[model samples]
Target chain A: MAFPDRFDGLPAAPRCEGVYKVTGDTRGNNVAIDVLGVTKVFGAADSGFRALDKVSASIRQNEFFTLLGPSGCGKTTLLRLIAGFEFPTEGRILLDGEDIAALPPFRRPVNTVFQSYALFPHLTVAKNISFGLEMLGWPATKIASTVERMLALVKMEPMADRLTDQISGGQQQRVALARALAPNPRVLLLDEPLSALDFKLRKEMQIELKRLQGETGITFVFVTHDQEEALTMSDRIAVMSAGRILQVGSPREIYDRPTERFVADFIGETNFLEGEAKVAGDRLLEVRLDAGATVKATAPDAALHAGRTTVAVRPEHADLVPGDGPADLTGVLKNIVYFGTDTHFHMTLDNGVPFIVRQQNTPGEGSGFSIGEQVGVRLHADAAQALKD
Target chain B: MQPHEVEQAAIRRGTMRRWLLSAPALVIIFLASFGPLFVMLAFSVLEKGDYGGVKPWTFSFDGWANVFFQHDIFTGELGFADAHLSIFWRSVRLSIITTALTLVLGFPTAYFIATRPRKTREIWVFLVTIPFWTNLLIRTFAMQEVIRNEGVINTVAMRLGMISEPIQIMYTDWAVLFGMTYVYLPLMVLPLYASMEKLDFRLVEAAYDLYANRFKVLRRIILPLTKPGIIAGSILVFIPSLGAYVTPRVLGGGKNMMLGNLIGLQFGKGNNWPLGAAISITLMVVVMVALLVYVRATARAGGDDRGR
Candidate 1:
């Protein structure tokens, strides 16, 4: 496209003079945003609601990072702090190598797509996109050209002259993203930006957001309560709860090797079995379940201290053995539920502890277990991991 | 009847019921507003009476002409009465000035109230409307007590060793302007507050995050969005101030007179009821012209907003 040539060899995003400086990154400033022990307390210093408690994380450049948590878990508060909308009560936020904790929102090279997609009702879609460049005193020609490029970027060229309120909710979301990205902020904060859409559209936009992040090369800090969204779109996910980050890792690592019980329970569906762990060997632990079953499990790297252990087994990892077979644990079949692609066997262990085993509905298997019958269940090796309580 | 014809008859019935429901309001507006206005127009075209009433059925152009011209007693020739023009000018100038001043004071107050926490916002709005609970005359008089010489301000300042003599603030344009602005302030604030209250402040935050400072945010995002409130509040403050009689009379001390006070003089001491009615209609015409200007301004703004 002719668009790339117009920016005059600069790059995907613009570098407005005072908003961001192009000083080469040194002193381990490869991280786009380095948050150091930031604390945010609202209302009163002595007895305020602590939204974020000494949270520290590093968001790498050009990575789609997500803060995943339930409601009121301080994910949005951390995003606001990085955007400079709210100041941290302690510590500092560094964008590149410089401290930006004292700067107001306008002085930082950051933008946000608010949860409501707060578009300007008074301006046309085109003018809304041009507002940032205009505020930076870009010449009229440059603003017009850049606005055109942004219109084409979001595929909203036909709706350029329409007022923001004249469009659908999804269209407004796109316009908001285009407007925020027009000025070429180094980082873009999304506060549950896709939470308002329907399920189908939310899925579509999730893919679109990832594509946009890849194309723009701007670090994306997405906040969401949907674990599936974080797992599907994020390069790294930070699990937060009660004003503190519980864990941070890739989606596979978070799903496979969750260190905390909360992380394991929050990221995906799992059957948590309470157990006591004794060191069986290096990288292994023998967990004696409260249900009077002893199962061998892998020891997570971080949760190896002397403490109680909880084994999290994904529902799909176990299979139902009908009357008797070579199985490690035994239970009585209570009920069975059928999903489209899979069937779940709900049963109770010998001591009344709930157990669920999910199996794909393979063709012509002809295996059935009646309720009120004792059954044997076998867990696949390496399916269990010890989590810290 | 045919099936489609029956449906059409039902639609007609619904429309007729709506018009019937609205008829009482239309009748009240016509009788209360236009009825007196037609009488004034008729009286403005008639001749002045000798005994302080209109000479009914007497056709004359003198009543309308006397609004701009009067007979010179010595020359017996008609000429411009500059006093009427000055009174008209004072009324227009002060109304415009009062609207500007109220807007200057009310915008920040409304924004502050709007940006406050939702629970405390109600309390601040309640405080703003506290002045409306009292009578306008009482409030004007209360203001008179504060700014007048030998009043609260002069007494307090003198006792505090701030000045030796009282400042003459009572009988000037400043007193009238001050009184009018103070009385009309709530009108501006309420509409501005209502609009500011509905404003999505996340749009404001978005503006700031997109590289707009406080000034740019106000200019680009805040002001244009709240323009309807500005227009409504300006009209509310400006119209009442143009015809103000009580505030000017109580605080302006007889020398400074607005159009309403001048119209009162023509009916009482001047004994020219025709001229009084003539000037009243002229005042209405001025109001219409001012409203036309406001409508033109808003239409232009609305057109620009459409991005044609």
Candidate 2:
């Protein structure tokens, strides 16, 4: 679109100047936001809840970074600290190499589209979009032009006169994004803005948000508990559990080679086989399961001569073979689940653990599996990884 | 009966039963309210009798005439006088003042209470309502004691040497205004509290995040959202204060009489029941007109909000 040319009239993105810079990975020149060892404790010192414990991450400029976790895992708390709604009990939050930990919400150059949208019920869509510009003391003409541009950006020009309550939930979400983006904040914090919508609208908005983020070239720090959303839209994802970041990497890295058991379990469905492992050779490890099945997989860590470890593999990677041929494992097929495009074979391993294998629904494939039928499950060594128990 | 006719009859019976359930309360309200009103309307056009009662089958416009015109005893003619008009004007002025004062005091108080933590909100609301349990007359008397010369306020002021002589506060216009404001303060606070409690506090945080200062947040967001409560509280305080009787009669010291006091005088010592009924009906009409105006304004406001 011709939108990028419109922002040329505005000044360049704000940069910190004339201040003594902290020399560390936390405050790099190319980084848009640097959260440095921030610990947030709620309640009193004697007996308090540490909502975020030494959480540190650096978001690159124009990156879609996600803090993904379940509820109460401090993802929203970390977002609030960045938005300046909550103060961290320890450490600093830097914006463009300048510390903004002491700044109020208004003083900081960041805006948040709240999970509830938080639209002013009394104002029209246009008025809500223009609010931040008006607060910044822009001229009426400037604010009007900016508001018009924003409404067009969100494709909400026709509903500009409608109050917030008069619009649907998805429309309100777009208006919130427009309102936050109108001010041209350096970073926009989204606190699960799509969690309120139905499945279809949420999918549409997910793609729209990615497009908007690409068009605006603003750093987005999105917080959500949905792992699929993080994997689909984010340049990098931080997997958090129990107030600590377990892993931070690109989606492919997080999904393919999760460093921790929690990250492997939380990101997607995985079948974890408990076994004893030892380094077989270069780039390979052999794990002997309790049911007398020996499997070879790639070791995630090189310094692993492990006594006890777990082999994690996705259900799609494990295949169901016809008979008791040369196989890595064998189980009894307990159930078959048809899921439109694929079928899942629920099996009980010889060790009495439930194992699932998913196969594509090919046109010529026969109904070769049934309840309580004996089957052999084979795992591709390249697709499986050995993880610390 | 035939089958279809029997079905129709059952439907009729169902409708009748529903109406029968609501008929009793509806009948009682109509009688209790319209009964006295019809009597008052009839009395307003009748002639005054010899013993503080209306004369039957005798009608005149003298009660309405007496409100705006003064009767000359010798010349047997009537002309305009400001006596009754001034009383009505004073009542309007006092009502407006009382409503304004209550709002000025109630808004901040209600906002404070509503902004409090959820655990302590009910306690503050209970404290606001504690005054309602006491008799209003006793409360007015207590106010009189506090504001009277040589009363609590004057005694304390004299001892503190802020003033050597006692202040002439009681039995004045200020005393009546004080009593009205004190009695009706809770009426204003309660409605304001109801709306403020339902206000979405997240909007306030959003406004702050958008760089709005506290005052702008209040002016643009809080005040506009809570306007319904303001209008409701104003009507609650204004209508009653317009026709308040005891406060003006006791604290006004008979020098500055309001419509309520004048209406009472016509029915009591003046022995003119027709004139009293006429004045009461006029005050009722004024209050009704005010309520209609408020409703129209709020409706238009709502329409404007949506139409835009």
Candidate 3:
């Protein structure tokens, strides 16, 4: 399926800078969380190492912002810091303009759905859903109605009386969501909420979570290591590595126009070609690859210097045709993998530079490219992105 | 080929291996433990000779009759009535006191130790269990020295002029309770620690998140979760305290003799094996009945909590 029309105006070719800010309709003027220069260290003073180093990001109210990174990238730690489970060794966190640095987890105006789903095993689904409401000292009548509403919202009303262990994992996840949402906190933090579910269930919950976010209008700060999940669910993703954010933008911007080599490799599969750049025109540039070949690409920013650099070209951008054409590289097909909807051909260039080309699986007989067959890998030079050294 | 045949073969193999491995220890346990109990039962019902040894196979209730009906020859104290009523009640009272004290003190200490960080918790648990490694008699003697006149406490009190005479702190009921609690404190703490360590702190956190204060958390979440440990610790402390002879014998002087001492007297110096056996049998029956009742009550309570 194609992307929704709402995302059509998004830059088709990755733009380098000035991505749109995500401010949900419900929270026009509110800044839900303003985390500044947050740093966290683990272990004791003599041996402790930094886990988050001067990390800073602002999540708008009612926006579903995701902290995306690979494992050990401090994304979860940053989320935990925002949730008040861990205090930052340095820096400040402001919720609605109040410093919540010294606040305990229970006192913070946020609730977390832990990655483990940490439901009280002894409590029933109804009791689990109503826990936060009871904590807020709501009347029994109000709590009952609220729990019933949340149960319906998460489509778990039928299993309300079942023990957490009695229900399926998906049902328990909904109960956890209900429990966290029942408090009606200003921000709801999820730590890899869907990582525990099967692929289909994860996809189903992704839609449910997005719909719930729209309905409730509560700001959500989701942490995930899955790049696809981050792309699918986040309004804006903060791509992080080695305790620092490399780039923060909408999913399209992060994917299409990554700011660094780490962001490019971390977000999706890309073929890196080391080259030198020279600005050719207002929006065009010439890159000389290390293999003594020159190619044309879009110059996204002035940071593209006239020195050795790397060019990141996504696999889908490279087209495999019948013969050599403009801005083309000749190669032999080493491997072809048919993945039901698309075919990927691993091609090695004449200079021994390896690259992949992916073609959509259309109806009728598609291109029958065989292994060890000679082919020309064509590239739309405009689709290639020039990166800073 | 058939399911029943396969099942039978597996069962036969399992039984053969189990018997081969356990036969020696099982025989030794039966001979060493149950043999004496059977002999005691038989001797309790047999007739006593004029010289006071058991008359083999001459079964009679004369020994039991003498125990229940006969008065003391020396002090005219009713042998059965006074010993059974006073000594039994004294032992029960002392055991109840020790068990309650152990529960009160051990619960907090166990909770603290269970909640410590991993490395520090290991050290604390080790310290709590260290006292149990010492000899029980040696521990009792150490307590004796601490509470005795001219011992460390009295020496200090005398030197400070807190009292003109060395306080009569030793050989009292308080001293007996103190010694019992000291010796059995580790037993109570260890079991309670085991249960409390398994307690998910998240439950307590959940309670607090549900607006439960610290005291409410203790009463509702902690107390109910650690009930098994409390029950087990109480039984451990109470059963041992009821049958304790040495601690009271040394610390209670001669004034506060418990049932164990009386049972010992009847069998040893008193030369009445049937009465001693009957008393011992009665004490065992009472303890067993108490244990059964406690277990039944706790099981019912646990069921009710789950129902809620």
Candidate 4:
């Protein structure tokens, strides 16, 4: 079948019949890792787990890329394949236009900061940073200078002589980063390096990691299960589920305009309103909610038809108005939740669906509406996204 | 009573309770160990009686002197002799050889078993312990059947035309060494496997990612991490082989007597009870020295690990 014109670097559709394509500029024209049609299966032929199926993507040079998914979603498998700890059962992994699928991990010019930190307890911090350089048969003087430079980069000069177990968790993390980046590999892979740190430390390390990437200008392929971390640090995010890439886009594009229901729900909270979609005009569409309310929205392409679809709306996008104003839907205010920065108005729609509207608490914005009072909810034209069921 | 006095009395009562609870085990160990040790110490310095006994009333240093010197019984003059010294050195050599061989054989076996998948790992470990189900004497006797002049190995080798005549493998120090290694191999493997199982294999992947090949990874990562197990297993094998009696008697054919056999003869046919006790004391001292060295080395390693 002839598919629609997809945006550049968009993955293949889930089904073979057709695809609803998004239009945007292509990303990462200069590729670092070309994972073409990779399929990996673990264990025997009769009984095995299919960790990845026909997974393919291009990681661009000097980009902070993330493979974001839940646990057991093949994100780590893909990372290991690129790191050469694992090989694809089928297809190829190319590094700089060379097929490195058959290469051993020692021969691959890539390093990984393991999730557990995997620091050698027997070695000091300086020795850990110098291991890769020494493995390359570098001279002792060169190794010493490189280790010194890495210690300075990670701001760990004081703890260089300390054993790995003697340092704190955050220090170990910096040491791991310095070790992985010491050899100046063409690409670096990190497997949830911040998961072991505390909340404040994680936040600090996120900015530090981004700065390190920018300073070194090395391509980074990071794997994480945390959506917030991916959104905060990554240049681009590939949302994956059930061994398939659901969507790949910038953080703003993913958060503001998610095309998949999984992506919409996984990245942030959204309301799935059941509706029937119909094309109203060029680049304009309407979804009739089950409660006989028509919501207008804009479609990325002309794939909207007169059929059943789901309208996704972020909780913060809905506005609260007076009970007598012109609104799309009316509900009884059930409760009011006071957050420090924002307030949520929880209500039950006339059609018996729970609706929540978040509003920022201005200085003088009083709790004007009491509980169990009637209220009107309004939606902007650009807020709703109609997705396939 | 005052509060402080009451607290002190309670502390004293708690200490008495704990000591009472552990008194039985402590007394048993003291009786089983120091009881015979005191008797042996007294026997070493006493005068030798005619009927293979120690004279209770007399004291002499002749027993210690007889270890490295010969005395003309009639003249009562002492001269240096190296016969007993040679026996002690032979025992040391055999122990070292047995420990080395077991270490070489056990490391690979333990590594192979530890690296297997979980289900198969249990089975391999079970197989390693299978030799313990039978008696050691029965097992050593069975080993004799394999290495004897008309044994299964000789017959097989003759049929394969590898040798025209049967090779003399039995009744030699080599046979004794082989028997000791076979008997003590499982002791070495168990500790090695225990330590190897606790190793984090992710460090190996990190090493590989850092450009270390297989040999470098093993040398730099696996071997050094498992050094504690190697030391423990070596001590287990070495101590037993040093004082081994049965294997040397049956396999060495009484041609090359180790310290155990020599000490046994001094008390049995040789009828020198004082000398026998003296030699036993000397062997215990040597073992104590070996243990002290190991303790010192491990303590240093521990101190270094603590960043001292």
lDDT winner between 2 and 4, please give it.
2
Model 3, residue B18: distance off in Å is: 6.7
Candidate 3, residues B1-308, lDDT tens digits: the string is 79999999999999999999999999999999899888777777887665556778788875566544667789877556654677788899999999999999999999999999978999998999898788888888888999999788989998999988998878888999998999889889989999999998866655554445677668767898788899989998999899998889888888888878877887787777777777777788879998999899988886654434
Ranking by TM-score: 1, 4, 2, 3
lDDT (C-alpha, whole model) for all candidates:
0.87, 0.87, 0.80, 0.86
Q: How much does candidate 3 score in TM-score? A: 0.83
Q: Give residue A190's error in model 1 in angstroms.
A: 0.6
DockQ category of candidate 1? medium
lDDT of 1 by residue, A62-170 (tens): 7788999999999999999999989999988988757999899998878899999888888899988988887877789988888898888788999999999899888
Clashes of each: 0, 0, 0, 0
What are the per-residue Cα lDDT tens digits for candidate 1 across B60-179? 878789899978999989899788999999999999999999999999999999999999999998999898899989998898999988799999999999999999999899999999
| TM-scores of all predicted structures | 0.94, 0.88, 0.83, 0.91
Query: Per-residue lDDT for B72-156 in model 2, tens only?
Result: 7789687774789999898999999999999999999999999999989999999999998988778888888899997899999
lDDT, model 3: 0.80
| Highest DockQ scorer | 1
Q: How well is candidate 4 docked (DockQ)?
A: 0.51
Query: Residue B19, candidate 3: how far off, in angstroms?
Result: 7.6
